[model samples]
Target: MGRMDDRSVIVTGAGRGIGRAIAERLAAEGAAVAVTDVDEDTATGTAAEIGGKAVGIHADVTDPGSVRAMVQRAREEFGRIDGLVNNAGWDKIGPFVDSDPADWDRIIRINLYGVLHTSQAVVPVMIAQGGGTVVNIASDAARVGSSGEAVYSAAKGGVISFTKTLAREVARHGINANCVCPGPTDTPLFSSLFEGNDRLRDALVKAIPFRRLARPDDLAATVAFFASPDATYLTGQTVSVSGGLSMV
Candidate 1:
């Protein structure tokens, strides 16, 4: 039997990239997944592709009302929510000094506030049930700042800290919260960052001890581990899946 058999999970921003991979992995492991994304079509498409107890719902994590509705729908679909994966995020690369304040607001809203909205809406459900798991997808940039990603780093850093505190507060209620920090993974977002800069891409590859970027499946595997029974004793921790790029 799969480790996550009979479990139900709600994954935000699961329409594509790393989030999609996480949903696919968990569903493969026998978990019924609620794949929620701001893009309704992508969400439904992903759910259709996974084809197992997965259901796609339109959810905007930045809005508490949307998040609450998403959580409610998941419960209605699966009877109980066993896991929550906060993986929806966005970023624009550029000099911090040149960054627009408006961009900063948008970045913080989606990256930081999004997590808060989902956690607040879902944690109570986990409490009502016996236990559950929370996996927040942060970034290695949060641990060691990345150039041109100041605000994004700040937002992810907040996520890391929020997760730790949330973990402490919820542990007594049988809920485990953890954060996963991914290095420069080979996602569409990463590709967009170095579109015309092969030199920068090659430099990054050389800098990484592994000589390659991380795959979406790589991050997905770690998330699955955290969501499974194997991680029952772990809580309030941050695991970096950066292929040794950052050893802190």
Candidate 2:
């Protein structure tokens, strides 16, 4: 049997990139997943490819109403919620000094507020079910600040702190909360951040001890571990999956 057999999970931002990889990995381990995304078509497409035991639902994590509906759909489809992966995030790579106030709001909304909305929507379900797992996809920038990602780093840092506090509050209820920090992974978002800047891309590659960017699968494995029975006793912890990029 797979590690997550018969479990039902909701993975936000599963339309593509690291989110998609997490969903696919969990499904392979026998978990029925609700692939939620702000983009309806992309979410549905991801669910379709996964075949039976998966469904795509529109969820805008920045909107509480949308998040609530998304959770409701997952419960209705799967009968119970066993795992929640908060993987939706966005960032604008540029010096903070040159950033607009609007940019900060966008980063905070998608990166920090998104996590809050999803967890608020899903945590109660897990508590009522007697137990569940929550995995928040943070960034290595949270642990060690990144040059061009000041606001993004701050938002993710908030997620890390929030996870710890929530974990303590929910431990008695058998719900686990944790954060996974991914380093410079080779994803669309990452590419877009450094697009048309070969020098920056090459510099990032050189910084990593492995000399190669992290594959989506590299991150999926860590998230899977957090959502599995193997991590039942592990909570309030932050694990980094950056291919030796940031070691603390």
Candidate 3:
């Protein structure tokens, strides 16, 4: 049997890039995934491509009401939510002194508050079902400060702390929580960060011990592992999938 046979999962921001990779990986392992994104077309397309019990749903992570409706739809479609991957996030790269307050607000809303809304929505479902797993997609910046990602790093740091606290609170219910920190992954988001700067990209690649940036699949594999039965005894942990970039 597949690792996630009969499991139902929600992967937010799953339209493309890292989120898409995670959803596709989980589906390949036999889980029915709810591929959700703010963009309905891409979300639906991804769901169609997965072509099983998967469903595409619209969810604006920054908005709790939208998140609630999305979670409700998943529960209605799948009967139960066995897993939740908080993969929705956004960032603006620049020095803190040069950053605008609006940028900070956006970063906090999508990266941090987004987790809060989704986790709060999913935990109840998991509780009623007796147990579940939460694999949060944080960033290596949170562990070791990134030069251009001050607010983003702070938001992700919050995620790590929140995951640990949530893990402690939910362990009694058999639920587990963990964080996966990806460093310089070759996703659209990564590309956007270095839009016209191939030098920056090349320098980053050379710095990684693997001599390359991480692939979305790398993070996907870690996330899947945490969601699997193999990681039943693991919780409140933070793992970095950065090709040995930051060993903290």
Candidate 4:
């Protein structure tokens, strides 16, 4: 049996990237996982690869109703939720001065509001069950500003603050809420952010202390740690998995 054996967890944005890696990690640790994404096909595809222990649910973390439904579906499938990983987020880069309202809104809605939506939905269930763990996937940009990611950085920074508040407020009820901040990672989303420029990607690799970009699994491992019993006393904190890029 694994450290999280028999537990049930939900991982949002599992359709791709770090979210998909987190879902896979949790499942491997023997948790009944809810692999959720706005795209049904991709979510189900990941769940299938995680074996029969996972259930795929279509969810838009920015939507309260969809988030509620996701929580309901998790309980229905696994009987209860013992953990949660808020891995759903989106971003667009440009000078904040000229950034489109639509892009700014989208980033805030998904990266910040989604954390609130998903956390509020699952906290009650976790409370009812005595306690649970929550891992919010934040970004290094949130901790240290990025050149072209002003709004995105703000949203993720909000998440960091939200996590601390939520962690303290719910700690008495047996819930642990924390965040994992990752630096540049070699995921499809990372490539998408660079506009398919191969040289730019190489430049990014040289910027990190490790002389390499992080892997989705690298972030996933930290999320999994925060979600596990090993971190029972850990809460109201942000753990940076940025390959020594940001030390705090």
TM-score of each: 0.99, 0.99, 0.99, 0.98
Candidate 4 local distance difference test against the native: 0.92
Q: What is the C-alpha lDDT of each candidate?
A: 0.96, 0.96, 0.96, 0.92
Question: Candidate 1: how many backbone clashes?
Answer: 0
Query: Looking at model 2, which ten-residue stretch has the lowest summed lDDT?
Result: 46-55
Candidate 4, RMSD to the unseen true structure: 0.9
For residues 164-243, could you state the per-residue lDDT of candidate 3 as single tens digits? 99999999999999999999999888898899999988998999999999999999999999998889899999999999
TM-score of 2: 0.99
* Candidate 1 residue runs with Cα over 4 Å from true position: none
**Shift of residue 143 alpha carbon in model 4, Å:** 0.6
lDDT of 4 by residue, 77-101 (tens): 9899999999998888778898999
Backbone clash pairs in model 3 (N, Cα, C under 3 Å; residues 3+ apart or in different chains), count: 0
Query: Which should have the higher lDDT, number 2 or number 4?
Result: 2
lDDT of 2 by residue, 1-248 (tens): 99999899999999999999999999999999999999999999999998879999999999999999999999999999999999999999999899999999999999999999999999999999999999999999999999989999999999999999999999999999999999999999999999999998999899999999999999999999999999999999999998898998
Query: How well is each residue in 1-248 modelled by candidate 1, as lDDT tens digits?
Result: 79999999999999999999999999999999999999999999999999989999999988999999999999999999999999999999999999999999999999999999999999999999989999999999999999999999999999999999999999999999999999999999899989999999999989999999999999999999999989989999999999899999
Off by over 4 Å in 3: none
Q: For candidate 2, give the lDDT of residue 137.
A: 94
Q: For residue 143, what is the lDDT in candidate 2?
A: 94
Off by over 4 Å in 2: none
- Residue 86's lDDT within candidate 4 is 94
